[model samples]
Target chain A: MPNAQRKTSKYVDGRWSIVSSQRPKAIRALLGVLFLALSWVGAQSPAEITKQVQANLEKSPWEATVSGKAQLPDGSSQDVEFRLQVLPGKEQVARVEFKKPGSLEGNFVVISEKEVWNYLFLTNQLIIQPRAKANVQGLGVNLTSLGDFDQLNEQVSLKLLGEERTAEGAAWKLSGTPKDKTQGYSSMEILVLKADPRPLALTLKDAGGKTVADLAFKGFKRVNLTAKQLKKYPADAEVVRK
Target chain B: MMPNVVHGVPNAKRKAQDAKRRTVWVVRPASYAVRQTLNAPSLGARGEAAGGEGWGGVFHHGPRATGHRPRAFCFWLPAIGHRLSAIGDFRGGIFALVVAVVAHVLATSQAQSLTVGLFAAPGYISPTLEGSLELGGFSLSARLKRDSLGLGVEDDLEFGPAGRFVFGARGDLGFGLQPLAWGAEAYLRGSVAQFGLDARLGYASAPRAALWAGERNFSGFAGNFNASYRLDPANTLRASLAYAGDVPGAIFQGSTLGLEGSWALREGGATYLAGLGFRVGAYALLGWRGELGEEGTLLDATLRLGWVNRLELGLFQEELRLRLMTTFPLGGVPFEAAASLEAESLRGDVAYDNANGRWTVWLRYTFTFD
Candidate 1:
């Protein structure tokens, strides 16, 4: 559930080039001096930066619509679109709806309190499963785990990978290496906007250093939801047993 | 109401008040549900104290203060009557049966929710309708499923409070219209949490194509026990053992044990531009056919890929059997189209070697309304 996205096969590791090439020689020297001064003033630790990102997520209830593509090992790619609505409270609820592909258009999943309700619109089948089975790995952006610093730390090691300006804005780049090798991906890089600590993008890689997926985030905003509206999500659906 | 996102301006005061109002709306219902759970009688414990089955001992679990539950059946009588009067139209009768079950569930349910869905393939169509009602610590659920092969109605009643063990009984009636066979099944599910037991006692004589578990022309009891372990957030290990036998006859017409592990290898995502996802899994099954005194083993591997979160293709194989399945949108009102092709080939030196192939196509649509 880390704010990680699987990179498409088209992904090229540009971190080294961006760090090595983009800046002008004068600005590079000035930035080195600024870094020395900032070091003297005590820069934020990787843990602190990761926590700040988590805090930014916990600041309110928010919803985001993410769209991206996944490139398969076969070299074919699939389109992906989903809306993530996070209802924060005593029992946090995250609802995801798969859009775009006509086949999965009405597929909906709701997770709360260690349980998940997966509704397959095509079959009118609602499958109830344990929440542990609902990990949001490789999904580009994990809204449910955005505020879960403990979960992130438990699963992977975090390190600040320096900074750069993206299409969005100036940001802090961080790398995560899974503590357990069995995870979906070997490592991931995340970009967080420095101005607001908002996560902007995630790029994941395999152990061979090949790009797996790239996820970009946009349209993040808070929405006030009434209790009735929140409760209506899972409570009304009839439970179907297989 | 939160301030609308217009152009790029932030209206702070309105958003803050809207946040407060939203908080109240969510908290109230949650608190009410909690209160209701606390006030309800411990239905599971009572059922255990009185022993399972036999209503004469104690019917406490039957019909709660919600008298509307029993009254819910009133709505079904008329529809059932209509089906009985038009017995020749068995398909229509099956459709009415599903509607009645949904109506009954809605009438008795505090939430009054019903779910309906269908899956169709060349030469086959299966539609399912279900409804559930909750009263105190007890819940009643009814489901009706009909397909080209057969029709089945299952009723389940479970009792337990939240965060505790649950116990349930199920009654099932199955009709095989094609072969004109009828069957019934009774079972207990989740009777003990540590055991993860679900046992069904059944009597069936339906054709293999129309019967459950592909059991043909047999009357017997069959059930399976399942258990699972979570290796991590993304991996789950599961195993099950099953037993089936003919009634007043062979105690083991068939027995099987299977194990499966599923990993969420690569989760897919999408935005307005592009999306993709993939997962891989493998499982093994070993079984014995007592009647034929034959033993067999099956190993299966599967891979699923999604393109733009729109098209999905699944490839599966077991031993000499190979299958490919696909589901993609047809673009007309978001229609979903599915196709499956399977082939089984004989291997090893044999006097006569041959292979069999099967294929099916399906179109599906889904809708939801209060």
Candidate 2:
């Protein structure tokens, strides 16, 4: 009877060990399939990524505070603080405060989805200009006050030039050209985060193959903004409606 | 009684002839009376200063015995009247003809005229057309334009699409002072976007001569001093320095320097133009926000072929353009309509706003008046 009990226990222990050995191999196979699927999804064109980003940006209204230093063309540097409020299915509004080191100091411009208002802080007056004609002169980039993604595609051709890891370690890389020959931009590169496919950086170059502007976004916080916060532009700030 | 006197005069004449074989004759008072009654209007003495001899001395006196000479009094009156009337009529007719010819010549030389128009592209592309009429050293011009674009936004946002259509009128008064050409223009522009007041001063030193200085709202304080020598009537080689900059509140302020040359083949109608340009300095100073710099180098080449009737075909890079244009009699109004198809290959890295590699169709139109 003692020998029979010992044989039964040994048989059970061997069976459990065999099942454990086979399970690990099955799990490895499943993991391999999942990785291949993820890579295939990452290889989509920029148009595909644009569609996805547009859909996601439209899904919710978010607020973000952005702070950065820009290198100006004159070899000078300036610190910029930007406050942005985006409303889903509506226009995005932003207030930018600019501060330079010396004699160059003023509260100048306000941009909404439809218009751009220039404030002369000294005289406390605002100059409203059409969003279409407003000259925001850093890099000849004319942001359409009411442009859609499809219209943007018309202005600049979007192509998925393949994925690349940017110097700043972005999630995805997208490259494109200005389909409109007259659009001053020579080409565009967008660095998007892989986790949410959000654009983290954008660079604009002129027709002469020189970098005109480079923008990077840091500390992005996705928050549901209130309607009141979205309307933060000053009432006296001259509104320029398209 | 007169006959008796004349008989006495004959007896005296016979005695005088007998006494004067040496040719001496005497006439009495009765003979004088008879001469006076028969003499008609006297013919003025011929060669009076030296009236020494009569014609050949054939008779040595007037006709002696002729019947009364018949005179046609009515014929004289009518012939004189007819000649005088004809002379008067011809004088009046010639004056009227001269006046009519002068009026016709003046009317034919006095007509001169111009027209302009503008159109828009599908995207934020705008082009302009202008026409001018030159008359008596002055040119009046009309300009039309369509501009579509987004307004003001910072580096991070997507610009919305907006557009404006503009129509303007300008008058240029030019003076051709030999080695120097000078002109000034005053313009008023009205548009759906903004109202503008424009004034310009221009000086050009001949067509091939290098220096030009002009100011326009769009081009800013622009000066182009290019030294060009004509290789032939159809080709030119040029080296130039050009500068243009805008003030703080103006539209475009970038400055650039360029080197360019043009060649014409098969006459001036077909041309090949090539240019290389580099941006030189700060484009603008936007207050304390930042300074915009004009940075880059551009290389461009274009070939244009024109037909006899002012039809042009242009091949530029990957673009093909066909245009039809003509000038009419009234003020040299030229109407040009063009269509183009462009396919371009792009490779480079651009600071990104919101564009990926893509393809699109572009259409543009413009008009010029002169």
Candidate 3:
């Protein structure tokens, strides 16, 4: 899954204003030149940054744990936690195992290129459906997009809002506007770590500006994941295909 | 249904009664069972295959004779059960409470997942007290059952050379968790891409015939070679061929060649599960399970036309069986129920007796929390 640590809800726009009664023209001129040169070399377009992030993510199979509050389809918020594993290839496969929301604990979902497998722990039943027919949006948000940057880009148009420093490193803040009017979320903001070139957090908001999902990623690392491993389920689990 | 969280004010008095209050609400997992003999008279002398097994190390799917309960954490139930049994008096149901509390504490400390459930079944012949704790891939489930506290932890862990894919227990003697039936099983099943393979072996040594395995359990030595291929995203076809012996093969319901296929159909924005399968063994059997979806999957029903073993009659009896399973909420608690009715009316004997018609019903409440 995308690297994330949901930013705290508290936002304080505390800026220090510096005023100088005496101005040195030459020093100011030098600083302005230095600033422009830095911008020229350091600034990157949103597409370039997003594509680079996707490249870093698709380079290998990785696993991540995501946890936060997510808006339910009914507009209520609930604590949700899950582990996501993405096996990148010509055909990407993603596996999700829910860990929180006690009701959904032990349930798992596997998304292949063509199908989505929802395995219910209580019934030991695997419900399969064509990818197009299945609703992967979880908790009123596109959670799987957190694992696929390309899919995220396809769903929205991204623009680099700014950059900030965090404990992990400098991070680029990207604002996204849903391309599809009826998308679950009207807008979203993502924090992508510059050094690692992967998402660190994502916050989604509906058309009404209500927080839809605030997810954070942690414990992300590449592993030797195999197709057989990703496809494994209880052998006797009743199989149902749709 | 909504979960009823204990929202009462926290204090010494309330805290002291919290465990007791939960004891009244916690429930055992829902267990579904189907029993009764099959008389496949059409096939030669097939009575030996009947599961009314007597105890001579005859392997029975009987849960009451189980020494362990098969679960996702089948690997740990036995050891943990023994530890819990050795802890103190199970008759009081205090150990179950202790296990749940300890498990919950451990999970919270480690940031892991733990599910704790406990229930009492006084309607049974035995005053039964049961509890289970699940932590990640490891679990521990125990039941203080029977008049003499004959607790049998029955479950089998199936492991293939590659990995363990399935593990389960049968509710033969009813809720399958029996006291010290001393049965053991091991097997393996897994899939590689679209091709799936499964093989299993087991042994039953219930203390006595009626209590556990049969005297000459024909279900013993049950083995089968099964492979399933996914036709597409919406369909899967499994081909199973079983031999005369094997404890619990995937196709081990005594079928020689079993061809089964399952399909998931999308209709009116709802999913429906349909399966078609038939088994040709010493006696032929055809069966399939379907989901009755109305405003959701309201019920699961299975229909089977086949032959069953009549151990006493030494013949195969033609039989038709219909089983219905459903889950519903009662007072905010979810309860699972299953009923199977098999009639030999096709043989001109609709008599509901030991020889002709047989039926089994199972009901259990599932109140679980993490």
Candidate 4:
């Protein structure tokens, strides 16, 4: 009877050890699943990242005080300061009013989906021009562009330039190169914040790798713009037509 | 931050920006100039009088009197294997043209080809078909230009890294169909920082045309040197000197040296690029030019204003010129139209005998396709 009792106890102890080992394996499997789920949520694909950026930017109408520089073909450069007011709804448009460089103080530029118009303060001429395929110009870069990411991704090869710390905040740098070399913008680099994915800076380069233009966004804020404000510029009846 | 919150960058970043601004203000003025003439011979017959007979006789002229003696020089750039000369003689022009073409072909075998359209001032309505190839920093481009004035071929080659050394070469040959005129030109431009240099060799002969019944001819070589510094982002100050000498097989025999200082101001609010903005410039000119083997000193001034990257107004001495241009796309092709009008009334001893006020107006157009 004593031998039988001892053998039974040993058998029970062996079974308990096996059960303990299986418990650890079960816990590990659950932890692995949790980690993978977190990573999938946090790390986004390049296309997903671009979509996220577009979503954040197209949330509402916005305004900014923009100051920028543009380099000419002859190696010269120009600097400008202006107030940019954008209406990014279905009827989208952008209005720019010059503030610096006394000569252009009163000049105004209005851009729409159909065309771009310039109003000369001195001559009071309203010069209407045809629209471009894409508004890749630095001065025209903003959250207001319609089909901005679609236009860029379709024409150029987009890649993640990696994470960087900018004046605005931590950002992800993305670069685009024209697939069809003939595009006006040979290459462009944009900085969007990692936290919110809002564009902070845009740089456009020519084929020669010279910086054709660059726009650094500061004091960006959402605004409630009225329809009247976004309407066509109000010129006097005597406005000269060109 | 709330949506309405409107504060700029952090204090540290703002301070850094301020420092950058201060540095630019201090250094840019030392070498900031917008545009300076590089002595290429003027392309127009009127250019002979302003000491400006050379490559792009499109807009402005130089002095009317040359120096005390005729001095010539030549130089070479070992870095790019380029030899440069002013070439006051006809032989030099031919040599430069041949060398430029040969060097262009040899240096650029893998070049990209494309087409471009442009409407320049002074009634130059040009539609161009272009072919080009680029390797590293070197590129060679050839263009066939068709305009109301004539049909021409222009070639340009350039090499250099950005913000460092840049070397450029250009040559053009043109034949006018209606007026029966012939012209050929070669130009070189090189720049390092705030200093720039340009030289040109050119020849043009126009037989009795509809505007003028007499044969108008000019052949010459010109050189321009300039030092420029930007005062700020919007302004530039430049000082330049240009010298032009006559070539063989040409009627113009005198040389002139012109000195000028230009203040260029720009407002970029209208357009993003400096070339597309509202630009205003004032020039103070003092120089000497020679004509009919006679030399004389002359002084003049000019003011220029442009809008929307197209319209331009210029006032020089007692003359006023207006130019309007625009470009549009039609059926996958680009087209440009331009009109220029120059009204002249002589005030002082001038290059042209237009004491009686005269007005010249021209309308031109161009079309381009790939």
Candidate 5:
């Protein structure tokens, strides 16, 4: 009777221990499910975020000194700085000054949905052209111009390649080709912030596999701009009026 | 006459001696027997009868009996003269006839060798056919190329199609010596209704740099030199150097230098050749001129394998092109016709670009005439 009781007690202790170990695993699995559910809710559509950012830009009035470096076609590079401002119900204005690589020194103006005015400091002339369009022979299609989120999504088939963390923070990679054959930018990949979906970098490659242009956007604000800044154009700017 | 003088012969004997001394001439009768026996034409009957058997007998008998001086020189002189004269006349006639026949043959042959044809290409695929004639040392060829640059700016807006055509001509002159040959060719190339002409000159060494030049008025001056060496009975090595530049005051200007070598493998029913070449300089000078600093380089290589009488396959990879081509001959007249198909990179970039590729197909026929 003594041996039997002893064996029974040991078996009970073993059972309790097994129950205790299994309980922790169950709790950990529950926590993992909770985390996954939170992540799914936080994820946002790229198109939705893009539209919201553009709307915010339209209403922003701000001025800031922004500097960046860009890789040029010949394997050389260009660094540029600009003072920017945006006004409500008016064109956004920027005074871009190019520096470094003594060869290029110039100023350009980007008007909201209207035109670009480039000033050649050496030639003392301003070339103005209409903002890029979706047609092949024209400038090019700008994704930011898509006003409706659903329309933008349908027009551009976006493939999310992956996610990456950069100096600014985590960003989502989206790559796609033009659904319409006639569109100017045939294939492109853009990095946008997962939080705000603002475009961080954009690479535009031509049909020939040559990188036609690359643009990086940084520094954001929401405020009202002024009339003086809108009217001001750079002296010695050659206007390539298109 | 001397024997008669010694005996104080009579007047008749002296007369006979004198007659004998005089050159005796005999005339033959115009008889069927004589004509048949001697195979000679008969003299007149009257003359033969007047100079009777006495004269003929005296002439023949005296000459033999007296051991008289025979007129051997006189007999042979007429025969030798006649034979020489006949031979000279025959030779002159034969030489004249030979020259006349040769000249006539050349003129007639030249007329039978002329040919001409035209060809066209549709869409972005430019197809061309050309025919030429070769006679004496000269050859003339004409060719045309047409292609469509689909969906232009206005075409895209209006949904239309547009294209262009180019036409050209080339002439060549060739000459040769034992185991050594040379040729020179000039060509004028331009669009049918366009404002430009590309003229070129090419020269060659036997089995090998033929030099080249282009017209000064059209675009540029160019030169090329090539050499080929036989490594063995069935193998050869070739080398080339070339240069080109725009003429003064032309709208565009540039220069290029290139070198290349090829090895030919000839065995079985197929022949294979592989080669690599590189050119360093500027090309297409008018476009993107500002972006290209001073100098650029292009490296190209090719491999070709072919069946002797039936098919050929070729691959070319370069700084500006990557292509695979296959050709199959459909044996028939004009001469044998051939069809070629190719898949090529339009941008000539080695990197894969999802944007564009080109597919090309062409058919050609070759004919020869004498």
Candidate 6:
């Protein structure tokens, strides 16, 4: 009763701090629980983050525009731009239409569950082959792999690197090491937005730490897509199947 | 057929579109073109000879001579790279074929691949070269050699992403009888978000070669401007304008203006990401047309019915123009060849306009590299 009437308190930093026995235990316990909850959210493993991103993207048929820089197998950097439309289902199909690096303009690659179709605008020709035999082009980094975290993990080992304060808020960074030593690059970096937990940018570096690709994902939208929509082409285009 | 609104849409929607389409009837009898050629003199005086060899090939032959113009047949000889040559004299086609063979045998390596092509009517043969190269993300394409009536050496340079952009230039230097004809053009193109833009400007003056000559001297500025937006992956709306050159239906050969708004769609599995657009530029000729002057109309229809884009049937007059586009890649060759019997007119009749008809068969072969 005497301490409650003359509560002891101390001033610390910018605010006054109460270090007294008069505080309610229930309120203190609630604060502790809130802190723990926040810490738990922040402590998600890198693998969990990757899984979350994959699930979020696969929730529907989505389309996004990817534009940035990529490193070629020959160790040269190319400006890369393409439109990616993914229709996820039992018979999933994804189409990537390139608009950048002028060489591959109007070209597209369609990956389905069973096979892949590659169309070259310059030749007005379409080449269809089994996915197992299809070669990864436009950069050794497969454009379609980012949507599948497990596949990407096999290509490059990923770990939670750090988080950085961004204009929108904060973002987590994932640093990855390519498992294939034969590739020109050594490591990669991905920035994921914390607000929505989606990937924002990806950067690949050569063995010397030279930047290979620095692609930023933008104009992402979740929409209903069909296989026929992804398979659109010039009616007169040449089709070749192997 | 390329649907205007049918320019692109689902099959069901395209079928419901009210657009222009046509089937060209090529009656290439010895006497048929002779009758069409009889009216050539008046057309040439009107400067319509600039069209050179589409209604019947009267202009493709030098000095406006007309007698026993044997209907020409084109032969396909695959060369290394991509190039399109125009209207042929069979002998010239034969010569180009031999040259193409020699070029293929000599330069089939990653070093230097050559493109050889020939197009023939009864009196003229035009050959051309189109080739491309890709290094990293940088790409450069060039179409060298021009027929008497064809555009010469269109060069396209692209460096992109980081921001997508393309710079292209096409021009010609002609050593002809008149003041040595010359033309130059530069264009810029970019795609961002859902919008796309392309603009081009150029100037030209005629060499005045008789049929071998350019009749109309486009001595002033010519340009084409286009803007497009994608409503989605399946639908696109585009608006284009061509000044002092791309007259509608190409009714005026010299320089006229054209403005068009078109919507295109994609819905078939085989037609996926293939070449589909609103305007089917030329009826008898099928392929992508870059020139604004050659924009086709609603009366023009090109039907491509095939399995996997392999077999194409042009239902426009039972292949009267012999337009065949196929990519039967044998043994994983990844090459393509096209031969079309084309007869173009200099009017806007839209009903098989053979009024000032110019006939020429065009053959194109494309070579590819990864």
- Model number with the top lDDT: 6
Interface RMSD of 5: 40.2
Evaluation by lDDT, superior candidate among 2 and 6: 6
Residue-by-residue lDDT tens digits, candidate 3, A1-242: 11211121111111111211244777656655654564553466667778888899889999989889987654678888888898998878889887766545546788888877776543344656567756656765544455767777778888777777877887888888889887788989988888889888888898889899898878889998886677766432444333
**What value does the TM-score of chain B take for model 5?**
0.28
Model 5 residue A175 CA deviation in Å: 1.3
Chain B global fold similarity (TM-score) for predicted model 6 against the true chain B: 0.42
- lDDT of each residue in A214-240, candidate 5, tens digit only: 656656555554655454433111122
Candidates 1 onward: DockQ, in order: 0.01, 0.02, 0.02, 0.04, 0.01, 0.05
Pitting candidate 5 against candidate 6, the one with the higher TM-score is 6
TM-score of 3: 0.39
How much of the true contact map at the interface does candidate 6 reproduce, as a fraction?
0.00
Q: Write the per-residue lDDT of candidate 1 for residues B131-181, one digit (tens) a residue.
A: 444445355555444532222233333211001233455343444232344
Give residue A101's error in model 4 in angstroms.
18
Q: Residues B110-166, candidate 2: write the lDDT tens digits.
A: 312111122221221212222233234332232222211101111111121111111
- TM-score each candidate: 0.38, 0.33, 0.39, 0.37, 0.30, 0.42
True contacts kept of each: 0.00, 0.00, 0.00, 0.00, 0.00, 0.00
Q: Highest TM-score: which candidate? A: 6
**Candidate 6 docking category?**
incorrect
- Clash number by candidate, in order: 30, 33, 46, 19, 19, 44
lDDT of 1 by residue, A13-33 (tens): 243235537798887777667
Off by over 4 Å in 5: A1-33, A62-104, A128-156, A179-185, A206-216, A219-224, A235-242, B1-370
At residue A222, candidate 3 shows an lDDT of 91
**What DockQ does candidate 2 have relative to the true complex?**
0.02
lDDT of 6: 0.44
For model 3, the docking class works out as incorrect
